[model samples]
Target: MPRFALLLAAGLLACAAQAQATSFVMTTDALAGASVGVSESTSDLSSSFGDDKIVLAARDDAASFVASDGAIRGARLEAALRHIRERAPQLDADDRQLARAILVL
Candidate 1:
């Protein structure tokens, strides 16, 4: 009985950890739709395309946002810029502006 209780406690802990690690959401608009999530670490981007989701790890100074339906190409490009902004303060205003535009889209 003690062993069984230990197993049950371990299982519950695993389930709770899994839940805390993964987060996702769906968004839709008249023009397009997107589904986005953070990976198990919340440090990477997880994008779903139709039924498929891709996980992309980000740099230490970066944050990732996955768009609906696995539209990751654009999002990744934008993420790169954001990374620069967060990690490389030497970047000029022009660079920051460009990154902002990519993120806004």
Candidate 2:
């Protein structure tokens, strides 16, 4: 009985670890139109949200959002750029620069 309990505990721990490593997905359409313009900062992206225009869909560990129609895409773009800066410091300077440029627009 003790052996069985130990095995069960191990199984439960493995399952929990697997669940924690799982990825999530999200989608939004607020920036659908301005997908072309770029913002210089995350604040710019956040301010573009008008009422319910910015819709966020979150799943597990991931989230997606769309900007409102005609809203400036710069601020939202900046956020993605900032995320790369925060999450991928190992990237080369050129890669970071490209990421920043992409985030702006």
Candidate 3:
């Protein structure tokens, strides 16, 4: 009877522990293995909505975005590229292009 009571207490504790287990909303998606326009300072990239634009861009390339319907492409790309060059001073045109290729992949 003592062994049975001890087992019952242990089972209750286990159930309580399981019920109190902490959970988190984890969303840590790392970048591709290889990509062009590599932002090496992407340690804080996760959880940032800024990178979502890149994904959208990959889905809809510049070529597909035509001005036939009178919707002109913004100069944001050029500006963003310039900003990137400034931030990653070592990232040359070639590196940027390579990173871009990786991103598009």
Candidate 4:
């Protein structure tokens, strides 16, 4: 038990050191929900995308939207990715993988 605790602490320390801007406990699910909670920095993603006019959808429709140019209120794919990365500065490459199939702003 003590060894497990030590390892967990070490892992947390590493994450903290990596993204010093803000901390978060993000979900690994395809579409992370709002209730579980995250660091204040990432917390905005859970709220802004839902609260604001931002629309989040699966990449299954992205190719078509990208082709349309003005589809979905002219919300370009690049804008969505930029929005997420900007608001959630702690996002990593792996998170990008999970986000590849989703558009969020």
Q: What is each predicted model's overall lDDT from 0 to 1?
A: 0.37, 0.39, 0.42, 0.48
Candidate 1: where is the Cα deviation over 4 Å?
24-105
Q: What would you estimate as the lDDT of candidate 4?
A: 0.48
RMSD of 4: 14.0
Tell me the deviation in Å of residue 22 in model 2. 0.8
Count steric clashes of candidate 1: 4
Between candidates 1 and 2, name the one with more favorable TM-score. 2
lDDT of 2 by residue, 1-105 (tens): 999999999999999877665522112244543333333332333343212121121111111213333233445444544554565454343323333333333
**Candidate 3 vs candidate 4: which has greater TM-score?**
4
**Decreasing TM-score order of the candidates:** 4, 3, 2, 1
Query: Poorest 10 consecutive residues of model 4 by lDDT?
Result: 93-102
Deviation of model 3 at 11, angstroms: 83
What are the per-model C-alpha RMSD values against the true structure? 15.5, 14.6, 12.1, 14.0
Q: Predictions ranked by lDDT, top down?
A: 4, 3, 2, 1
Model 4 misplaced regions, further than 4 Å: 1-52, 55-75, 94-105
Clashes (backbone N, CA, C under 3 Å), per candidate, total 4, 18, 8, 0
Cα distance off (Å), candidate 4, residue 104? 10
